[model samples]
Target: MKITFITVGKTEDAYLKEGIEKYVKRLKHYTRLELVDIPELKNTKALTEEQQKSKEAELILKKVTSQDHLILLDENGLEFTSVQFANYINKRSVTSSANLIFVVGGPYGFDQSVYARANDKISLSRMTFSHQMVRLFFVEQLYRAYSIIKGEPYHHQ
Candidate 1:
């Protein structure tokens, strides 16, 4: 199954961008991985938090297709160990889904509509993280999951 990461906005920091790219490249060796960026909402100074979320949700929904299994990266979602996450990936691949899309919403988080559309939700950690930084963490975790699945030396217990 293909794995796609959909995040809002661009990674402006060069160091973060480089790190994210490194992990994405490593993940490609294990699966068809792609990072899809949803442009940041423009002129948000006047919009309310709910309004911003609604607008961002529209863009996020557009990136997803009917066949894709949508998963949201939410703080209140389920947390998994490296091995469990690898098993999750294995199950999805075995089922032959078109794509496994994991989305990282905008600054204020996802709207109600986005939440309703998600099939599952995952939490990387209990602590909050910047959207750009989350990209790096998420991609690296994905790489680690793949390595664990293959019984490689990259991950340690």
Candidate 2:
């Protein structure tokens, strides 16, 4: 199954961009990875946070399909260990034929509409992270998950 990772905005910092690229390159060996960056909404100074999320949700939802198992990377979502995440990946690959689409929403987080459409939610950690940093962490954890699933040495425990 292909894994499509969708993020709200481009990774601007050079360091974060470099780190994301590193894992993305490594991920090619295990699965088909598609990276989609939805452009940030322009002139957000006027719009309320709720309105901003609603607009972002429209763009995010457009990329999704009925056959896709959409999982939102949300702060309030279920938390899992590296090994457990690997297991989650393993089970999904074995059981599901649909594409697995994971989304990281904009600054104010996912809109209620977006939440309503998601099939599942996963939290990287309870602590908050910058949008850019989450991109890198998610990819690295994904790569680590793949490595662990294959019984590779990347993850120690």
Candidate 3:
């Protein structure tokens, strides 16, 4: 199955962008992988936190399709080991109705509507990281998962 990462905002740091690109390229060898960036809301200085989240949610939801299996990268979500994540991806490839879509929300996190729309949630770690940094981490993890699935030498216990 194709895997898509949808995240809010752009990765401004050149180093982080390069890291994300590297992992994305590696992951493409295993699946149809793509990164979709939703532009950050403009002039958010006057908007409330809730308003900002809701606005961001609107842009995020527009990228989603009815056939997509939506998974949110949430702090409070389920945490998986590398092997388990690979198995989870395998199951989705065998059984999911559409492309597997994972989302990383804006700084203030996701809105209630976005939460309600997700089919599942995953957490990379308990410690919080910058939203831009998370992109690199998640893409690397995706590559790791695929490597594990194929019994490649890239990942080890």
Instruction: For model 1, give the 10-residue run with minimal summed lDDT.
Output: 89-98
Rate residue 89 of model 1 by lDDT: 82
What does candidate 3's lDDT look like per residue over 1-157, in tens digits?
7888999989999999999889888887899987899989889999999999999999889988888999999999999999999999989998875998999999899999999999999999999999989999999999999999899999989
Per-candidate TM-score against the hidden true structure: 0.96, 0.98, 0.97
**Worst 10-residue lDDT window, candidate 2:** 148-157
Q: Write the per-residue lDDT of candidate 1 for residues 1-157, one digit (tens) a residue.
A: 7888999998999999999989988888899998999999899999999999999999999988989999999999999998899898888888865699999999988999999999999999999999989999999999998999899999999
Query: Can you give the lDDT of residue 100 in candidate 2?
Result: 96
> What's the C-alpha lDDT at position 39 in model 1?
93
Which residue pairs clash within candidate 2? none
Give the per-residue lDDT digits (tens) of candidate 2, residues 41-74. 9999999999999999999999999899999999
Q: How high is the CA lDDT of each candidate model?
A: 0.92, 0.96, 0.92
Top model by lDDT, which number?
2
Clashes of each: 0, 0, 0
TM-score of 2: 0.98
Off by over 4 Å in 3: none
